[model samples]
Target: MPHSHQNRIQAPQLAAVVVACIALFTDMLVYGILIPLLPLMPAVSRSGPAATGLLFAAYAGMMIIVTPLAGRFVDRRGPRGPLLAALLGLGMACLLFAVGGPYWLLLVSRLLQGAAAGLGWVASLALIAAAIPLPKRGTYLGIAMSMVSLGTLAGPPLAGWLAREYGHAAPFVFATVVLLIDGALRIAFVRPVPPQADDPATALDVLRVKGAWPVVILIAVGSGVTSMIEPILPVQLHEALGLDSVQIGLLFGLLVIVAATLNPLVGAALGRCSPRFLVFCGVLLAMAGLLLLGGGARHAPVIAGVVILGAAIAFLVAPASTLIGVVGARTSPPALGGAYSLYNLAYAAGLV
Candidate 1:
């Protein structure tokens, strides 16, 4: 399009995007990587359902507690310290996964990982918001989302394969090594962004900002709409179509693949389209998908619903996020961090 827009991704901005992508990818990667490997572990399997459930709670609970605080921290101090913490937290969690045997150790690892994930998401988004031109942030954020989708799509099967080929520790070892590279890139490419907030002291202050609540609600509903389906889609397919676990997993993978493929394109469209219009279209699509998801008794319709919903989510998430970034950036950079912290909380709430 415009030469000015093309020139937006200068070295620091490019590095910002790169590090953000890797940070998000690693955060999500750690999340997905353990999915298959954990159940296969004798200790984990023997731990029973209560303990297994607690394992997930460890991460999600910590994420919920830390997200808003991390947002405030990033806004005040900039993304530098939070980014470093992400690296260290993720690294240590991976190390524990690789070597530590007891359930307590694994539980602690999840806690560390959950906290790190909160830091990574807030810091990385703030980093890009600060580094990239406002006009281009949507597109770059979409690219980061695409990387996150890759981590989600790849993590389960990759870990399963690695564990099968080598041992239970293989996937964790690989993740630890990936974190090392992530560390190097962080040191080399992460530029410090000065704090920009003038009045907002906490994420709560973000509520006082005009035009912020709608974006926050949109993020939560848009994310929740898709996420709430994750557990249901598999079960619905199984009961209605008699699909096996493998087939259901693959069907769900289609949802991830569709969203992953479309997110960047949707993100780019934000530069040219009204964020409001894009979000409206996304809502319409989501409604249609929900109908199909609810009405369908046949396999084809359900599968189609999954694909459509995936695209609907891509459309919904990108524009809303871009708008929120705009809102956060209206005055100072700290607001941006606060906004994304709200984003993380909203996303986490959706997961719950």
Candidate 2:
């Protein structure tokens, strides 16, 4: 019995979660790192805002089409194979970005990278849900999202520093190296499992589970509200407070740090509190934070608002993810892939 217990403790589950975390962290890191480097790319520099706007559109466009497909594929197959493939695709995208490109190739790179990101999000969440039991997914998913926030926090600054010190290609080269390591980790940690028996069930089937739509909507709201903040905050802070880049970065930096710290706690909180209660609390906090930012004349309120907003996000994301996993696990034969693919769509819809 003790030996059996040891086997359970040493099961590949946590390794799977670790791989998922690494994949997400790397995906977001490269994504964050690219922000500073893109404008410096020859094609973007020549074309300016129009080209930059196109790249943004291209990423959203690809996510709309690719993320759901990736999720569906994961349902038919399994997370291991798809996760590795997505990492490889992400590496290639980094390579393309690293080498610099004509406008068209950069667009292709954005599209490929977006698709790979979609794949990574789906596969990682599915991987975690697959490896973790129902009661524990909340905490793990929270930890996973924390890594995401951390990636975003680190990406732009790191890219800026690297570019200033080394060259334009340095950021991508660094990202490529990281992806290779993530890929290798995937190979070692994610055991090759044969595909599951084909489920006739579609994504719709997963949604049909009672109360699924509410959680899905929560996901969309959680993702959308958070995303809608990114583009607007810098401009708002600049105009309202006359803050420079460093000040604005500091504000967002605080937000990310707070969110990262709170995410795991919210997940762990699930054992005691309900998802609805947590989300309700998140909504209230979001409204309060927005009010603080919108009306504040001084630094303290703005800073307070950012931190509160970060906490709100932690409350929103962890519960919604845990609920999604719960419902996804309910489907006959358990189509976590389909469930999380729908999650991708909600997330993308929110993002776009």
Cα deviation of 67, candidate 2, in Å:
2.6
Put down candidate 2 lDDT per residue, 247-312, tens digits, no spaces: 565566677788778877998999999877999999999999989887877888999998999899
What's the TM-score of every candidate structure?
0.73, 0.76
lDDT of each: 0.74, 0.76
**Model 1 Cα RMSD, Å?**
5.1
Task: Give candidate 2 regions above 4 Å deviation.
Answer: 1-15, 35-54, 75-81, 96-106, 126-146, 188-191, 195-202, 232-250, 265-281, 287-302, 329-338
